[model samples]
Target: MTGDGWNAAVRRRLGLGRLLALGGPEDGVWITERAATSVLGAVAAALPGLAVTSLRLAPADPGAAAEPAVPPPPSALPPGPLRVSAEVVALGGRPLPELVAALREALFTAARERLGLVVSDVDVQVTALLDDLPDPPNGGPPPGPTDQPASATATAALTTPGVARLTAELGPPVQTAEGHVRVEVATAPPHHPLEVARAVRTAVGRAAPDADSVAVLITWAG
Candidate 1:
């Protein structure tokens, strides 16, 4: 089908399937269904005020010798003049005045037109500049009396789970510039991997209430 055909199919008034059967670019715009969804999603995001009322695509004939690039139909979309905003703030210590302002503006501009919120202002602070650094090659503190010195090979082996072991075998799946807790556990026979991952994330959230995002990765053995 031609570009006009695509427009017509997607914009059809009666049935909605026309929008789903989106055809390739007949007018050098787009043709594939995935491409159509992306285009539609972008338009929707840009215009939050407008509500998408309808969507559909055209149909294809399998018996035809050659298929034409036909768009399903023109789906009804909301007309828009949407507005959205966002801001970033750092509490407590004072951030560099200019940097704080820049961060706020950057966040606001980035989230505008996507999320429908109005941000009046943002506050930022730089509480501390830590002087602590990782230990030098041989200048670190002596091993604690209670600590056991495991062989290098043994340490490496602990990093990878054995056939009977499941759940995380390494450090925390998510690490931040801020502090975080690492957890390692074994699950029973009836546990699901997805459930374990979700649980880990929830636990981390409880442990680090001030973090920005939580991440969880699961590895299994056997």
Candidate 2:
């Protein structure tokens, strides 16, 4: 049998055991709940027959706020919101099974960590695989916001204690030519939107008292 065939066998053996142990569909447990365990199980099942090194979960830092910094004088970085990527690596043989397993695990981890994410499914593409010699380890670029200018008001507003945290935590500000900026603000535990809005209005007035208005866009995170 081909290496691919062996890989499939390994996955099936491991998956069968997991399937047996898991409760039926009626239990309402999500398939994702078992994702990590399934992948690790598959790895263990194939280890004795295959030479495996180690499994690692490496997530890059989210980096500092993207809005505060000025853009570079030159060079090319995509413009817009921040970009983050997650990929799986196998330090073993050319097995489609293991590749799929690792990719799924990586995707699952990303979904849990990244907020406001919508994932259709984890699509695994086997970029590389080696034989007797260990597979080459993979590396991905560090993550940060794309090239964008800091809002004149946002930069200034963040200097304060309460307003600073709210502005920073919310995603990029939505600009309007009307000279009015609308955003959702919250306080410790859970503060009413009206209170947060009042606080923001006060902060903005303090920063730029001349500003026309600071409207609260919505109650929750926008």
Best candidate according to lDDT? 2
CA lDDT scores, all candidates in order: 0.30, 0.33
User: lDDT per residue, candidate 2, 49-155, as tens digits?
Assistant: 23233332211222421221112111112112222232333446456586566555554544333211223344444344444444433322211232333655555
Q: Model 2 misses residue 111 by how many Å? A: 2.8
lDDT of 1 at 218: 24
Query: Candidate 2 clash total?
Result: 0
| Model 2, C-alpha of 119: deviation from truth (Å) | 1.3
TM-score of the candidate numbered 1? Answer: 0.21
Stretches of candidate 2 exceeding 4 Å from the true structure: 1-89, 131-152, 155-176, 179-222
For candidate 2, the lDDT comes to 0.33
